[model samples]
Target chain A: MVKIYIPADTTACALGADKVAAEVALQAQKRGLDVELKRNGSRGAFWLEPLLEIESGEDRFAFGPVYPGDVAGLLDAGLHESSEHPLFLGRVTDIEWLSRQDRLTFSRAGVIDPLSLDEYRREGGYEGLDKALAMTAGEIVEAVTDSGLRGRGGAAFPTGIKWRTVLNTPSDQKYVTANADEGDSGTFADRLLMEADPFQLIEGMTICALAVDATQGYIYLRSEYPKALQVLNQAIAIAEAANLLGSDICGSGRDFHLQIRVGAGAYICGEETSMLESLEGKRGLVRFKPPLPAIEGLFGEPTVVNNVLTLAAVSTVLAKGAAYYQDYGSGRSRGTLSVQLSGNIRRGGLVEIPFGASLRELVEDFGGGTASGRPVRAIQVGGPLGAYLPESQWDTPLDYEAFTDVGAMLGHGGVVVFDDNVDMLEQARFAMEFCAVESCGKCTPCRIGSVRGVELIDKIGKNDGRSANLELLEALCETMDVGSLCAMGGLTPMPVRSALKHFPGDFERGTGNGIER
Target chain B: MHSSGEAPAVIVSSAVRKFADTPGGLLPLLHEIQAGLGFIPSDSVVTIASGMGLSRAEVHGVISFYHDFRDKPGGQKTIHVCRAEACQAVGSRQLEAHVKTRLGVDYGETTVDGRFTLEPVYCLGNCACGPSVRIADDVFARVDADRFDELLGDI
Candidate 1:
């Protein structure tokens, strides 16, 4: 009997993994081949999606981007053995991209069956929770603080301080909420982690509950991720049955109940306070700070609100010691950065490396430049709100302070590449339009300023008052930057300003070719 | 346009019974009703508000706030095209234009034949493959104008 592996991840399914799986099964049966099929998660090398793996003895041979049409030929070409086929890639681990990545959080991502408890346990899944349960709250917090792990969800806040705040707060009922509402574009690490190895997140959240003395936890996932929702729910149930979660967790007297709450397609809900509001069944509106979710949150009780990556890294921090995790990166940003390479690129996928790597290495070497084969014009780091960097800024290291020095942000580590065909003026306008459409309408600068920002860009594009409109647009960006209550309004100017500064010629050309609404 | 054939009230009551008691259950309740029926009927608001101890205005505000919820029924199928930067970098604008022209309907509008409803999504998280589209639960990647038509034909 031969064992075959195929990915059931959303990206793989989008690329026709399901159809490929069905065809493989049918062909194998018709050919009278003794084959056992297993559905696993993606290996994050998306270019090789629907990546079929055939396990022979100890090693797994790979075939890539396979479709339904490729299955019959694959079976005939000695699919069971490591045969020479057009799609065949040598041993899965030997792929340069997979071999180079320092995968700490995504260690079990594509290696294990997502829902198989036995497989997850074999790969060091719940060992973190076991170690966390043995330590006191202060020791757990100290370990996290020593790891120097900051929030990966854009803000770059210290994770240890947030946990310490929640631990020190006295409350009858506290909460540990994972911000899985990953609304940023060119980013899918949170979704990848949840769908691929959900047990890691569950184990991480359970460890958090043990650290903060929180009784309940909620993963505020966005409505866009239906697959993640299903996988997480199943994983939670499996963990509960195994005594990993519930009233008495893992033979301990403590209780921790976890649930999944789906967001209603609101991007602002990615904000921690807005997530708390949405969890309460209200419109996702941003709240004032100072009562920080740590002191007074989630039903007026203390809470530890963290990003998906932040919480997932907690498992690694506990299982391994703090010093072990802290030794990976440069400066304050420790641990691996999950860089998501997307947009017009020859090879776009997830690249997890330690901090301090240059952006040019990721775009040119790993991404293999543009898919269109045109000269690269710009690169947008972060999301819609992030700045657009020209070729000169590509050498900047991927760190929080390094990106800040270059007037860009490593927001969620999403690097979207664009060729020379792109229109910077148009991209700047879309940034304003996105802010206008998705703004929660809590602040005037974000609410009114964004709409006006769109109009100002339109006027500048048409050359109607040209210089005047440009000045007005700059002033408007400043107002939104300073007056807005949250990053939603404040960060709107980053892209607009960067576009104006780097690609001034696009505005001067005055084609007025605006995107159709 | 009520595709499920069950009364909107029945769907609303069932959803409320399942989620109303839970804290912060309104969003889940709304999702259930939308899943059962095609959309959330305005008449169901009063019932949901009363069940959850909220006002009708509060309920309406929530329904209007979210991009996913709709008060009126849509076409037989809803298609969401990603409009985020990653998709845009690989010609999603061209795909969007083609879809609008082919369907003869703008976003949030159903086709005359009630075959498809066009919607715009920020990101479907399939960033590696540009120009992603979602129909029902399935997401299609690297979709161009031609592939989109082929997908529509299959449906």
Candidate 2:
């Protein structure tokens, strides 16, 4: 029987993968061809998504961005035999976009059936858990520490230090919470990973539980991802049935129970303290820090709070050992960074590469420039809160310290490109507007200053006391940056400030057609 | 606007009973009630507050704080338009205007016929393919003005 594969990923489904899969099944049945149809995750090459693959001998041949209408024609053109077709791209492994990537953490993504335990295990999934089950808590923490694995959710806090603090903190009932509230606008790595290879996250969280002595774990996922929510729940049940996440794990007599806690639509909940508060069934407000989450968290107990990617990388760090994973990247940033190339780019997708790669390479070489075929003007790295880099700064290497030196951040590794027609002043105004809308109202600087910031930008755009309003906007941004309780308010000024610095012409050329107050 | 004949108190009580044992059950309870009843009815607030051992004010605060929760029922179908920067890069602002003009409803407002309610969403995680929109649970990508009209016609 010929084997056929199609992506069940949300992006692919949105692009009509479900319809294509249905068409393939219908065509096979009509022809009386014995074919095995399977749903796999995206290969991160989203441009070629609904990417149909056929297993022939040892290699899987690829074709795509396939639609239902094209399925019949593809079959007529010998799709089953992987013959000449316009959509066909030969072997999947040889695809240049995927072959160039250093897929350390995303090795199993788009490669195996996400929900199949047998496929997951066959692709070297449980080896990390097996190794972790044998190592002492201190040894597990030590390996992560040695690997230099930082939090992948934006903040570059070392994962080992957080676990060590939780391990040392005395608490009878601690918690391991994975912040899956990936609210970043231009980023989706967490959602992709959880949907494609959920067991990886589960295994990573289990390891954190054993290391921190916390038997209970919760994944605080955002409501935007309904598909991911369903996938994770099913994955957890599968793991439990397989004895990987129950009262006894692999007959080790240890315990780790995992559950998914969906977040109501509050972007502030992406913050650690705010996420903890939401987990406690509160208003998802940002909490004050003195006793960090590691010291006193989740019901006033010691907690281990790590981002989804940070936790997911633990599986790789354990499976490949510290030295093997650490050898990939440069400087303090060890291991590969999952760069999500998006926005107005021609070939936007997820590019996992070692740190020290230039933004120019990602945008121009990999992304193939703007989708509109226009000259690139600005690029925003990180999510909504990240700064917009101009042409001069595109050569900056994607390292944590390197970005900081240029007043930018490799935030969540999201690079959103923009063509020359973009209005930076409008973007600056939107940044303030977004801040005002999403603010938790915890601090006056964030809540009030954001509204005032929007007004100030408007006044500048109208050219009414332009210079004075610009100065006032600077002062307001400074206040929000220094006085806000958390990053939601504090970092709100990043995009605004970067726009003012890099694209001053847009503010000067504003037609005063700003968003309605 | 409790259009359903079922009593809000009964719906609230059942939701409360189902999630009362779970840790931090308020959000889930509220979610269940909304899922079953379409919205969290005003009269059920007191029942929910008392059942969960909290004040009515607290329950209201939680519901009001989150964007997902609503106090009243929306239109028959809800259309969430992505307004974030990534979408903006690929002409979502134009799509946003087209949606409002075509539906005769602004963000958070229901159409006159009660067929659709337009809402603004920051992102739907399909950034690679921009100009995304979500109608109920199904998210559609590269939604230009023509695509939006075609999708609306399907409904």
Candidate 3:
């Protein structure tokens, strides 16, 4: 029987993978051809989504952008016949887009049956947990610490230290929470992992639990991803049945129970404290600092709060050992980044590469530049809070410190590319507007300052207040930066400020077509 | 609006009771009630407040606070247009204008026939495929004016 593969990743599905899959099945059934169809995750070469791979001998043959209308033609063309169809790209492994990637976190994303526990294990899945189970709690924390695995949720806080803090904190009941609320506009890695490799996240969380001695865990997922929520919930039930979750894991007698908590439509909930509040069924308002989430989180208990990627990376850390995972990257960012290339990019997709890869490599090489075939003006390399880097700063390496040196932050590794046609002032105004809407109203600087920021940006656009207005806008941003409780307002100044700095011409260009004040 | 608020108190009580044992159950309970009745009625708020042993003010605060919960029910269909940076990069701002112009309603308003309600969505996590729209649980991507019209035409 010929084996057929279709990407079930949301990115692919959004691009009509389901239709292509169904068409393949229908065509095969009609022709009475023996075929096995499996839904795999995306290969991350999104330009070629609905990418059909055929099993022939040891290698999988690649074909892409295959639609429902093209399926019958493909079947007639003998897709499995030595990768020799018109759409064929020879070996799937040699596809340079994927071949160039250092897929530590997303290794299993496009390779196996997402829900099949057996396949996951067969492809070196449980090795991480197995390795972790043999080590002492201190040893496990030490391994993570040695790996230099910072929080992938943008803060770059040392994950090992956070776990150590949780482990040291004396509490009757401790909890481990995965902040899966990926609310960033250009980010979908958390959602992808949940949908494609839910077990990786589970394993990572389990490792954290064992390390921290927290038996109970919760993953606060964003509700926008209903498909991810469904897939993760199913995977959880499967893990529970398989003894990977719940009490008595792998006959070790150590208990770890994980649950899914979906967030309401609040972007601020992605913040750790706000997420904890939302988990407790309250409004996702940012809690004051002094008592960090590591010290006191989720019901006033010391909680191990790590992002989905941070926990998922743990699987690689344990499975491959500290040095193996650490050897891949340069600088303090000592691992591969699952870069989400989005927006106006031509070949926008997930690019998992070592940290030293420059921003130009991601936008120009991996992304294939702007979708409109126009010159790329600027790119936002992170979620909404990240600064917009102009073409001049595109030389900066994708490492955390590199971005910071350019007054930018790689919040969640989501790079949103923009063409020359983009109006930076409008983009700046949208940032303030987004902040105003998503703000929990917990702090006046974020709440009121954001509204003021919008008004000031609009005034500058209309050429109403000119230089002083820009100065006032800068002052207001400073106030929010210092006074705001969390990054929602604090870092919003990033895009606003970056736009002002890099694209000053766009600010005054809006004067002719005066936007309503 | 989706389903009518005929038995809002009953809906609220059942949901509240179901989640009574769960900690921080109020938000989920409120979500359930909203799902059932389309909008949480004043009567349901009182019912939930009593069931959760909270004040009406508390219940109202929560309902009004979250963007998900609606004070009044919308039209038969809710067309949530993506308005975030990714979507904006691909002309979602223009898409928003087109949607409003075509529907003859603003972002938060319902069409005169009660067939469509336009809502501004931040991001639906379909970033790679920009200009995503969510009509109920199903999220459609790369939605232009033509796609938008085609989607709402039958409904």
* TM-scores vs. true structure, each candidate: 0.98, 0.98, 0.96
| DockQ versus reference, model 3 | 0.70
Q: Model 2: share of native contacts present?
A: 0.72
Worst 10 residues of 1 chain A by lDDT: A508-517
lDDT of 3 by residue, A1-517 (tens): 9899998877788778988988888999999999999998776777788799988887788888787888998889887646466788878889888898988898888888889999899888989999999998889999999999999999999899999999999887899999998989898888888888989999999999889889999998887888898889899999999999988999999999888887778899999999998888777889998699888898999998899999999999999999998898889998888899899989888889999988998888888888889999989878888899998999999899988999999989998988888889889999999999999999999999999999998788778868899899999999998889999999999999999899877877545642332
Superposed by TM-score, candidate 2 places the C-alpha of residue A296 at a distance from the truth, in angstroms, of 0.8
lDDT score, candidate 3, position A217: 92
Accuracy of chain B in candidate 1 (TM-score): 0.96
User: Which lDDT tens digits does candidate 1 get at residues A1-82?
Assistant: 8899999999999999999999988998998988889999998899899899989888898998789999999888887555
What RMSD does model 3 have?
A: 2.2
**How far in Å is the alpha carbon of A440 misplaced in model 1?**
0.4
In candidate 2, which residue ranges exceed 4 Å CA deviation? Answer: A80-82, A510-517, B1-7
A256-341 in candidate 2: lDDT tens per residue? 99999999888999999999989998998888997899999998899988999999999999988999989988799999999999
Q: Is the docking of candidate 3 incorrect, acceptable, medium or high quality?
A: medium
Over the stretch B1-155, how does candidate 3's per-residue lDDT look in tens digits?
54745566667778989988787777778778777877777767777788788888877887776777787878877778989999889889888999888989998888999877788878887888787888877777788889888888755
Local error of candidate 3 at A220, Å?
Answer: 0.4
Flag clash pairs in model 1: none
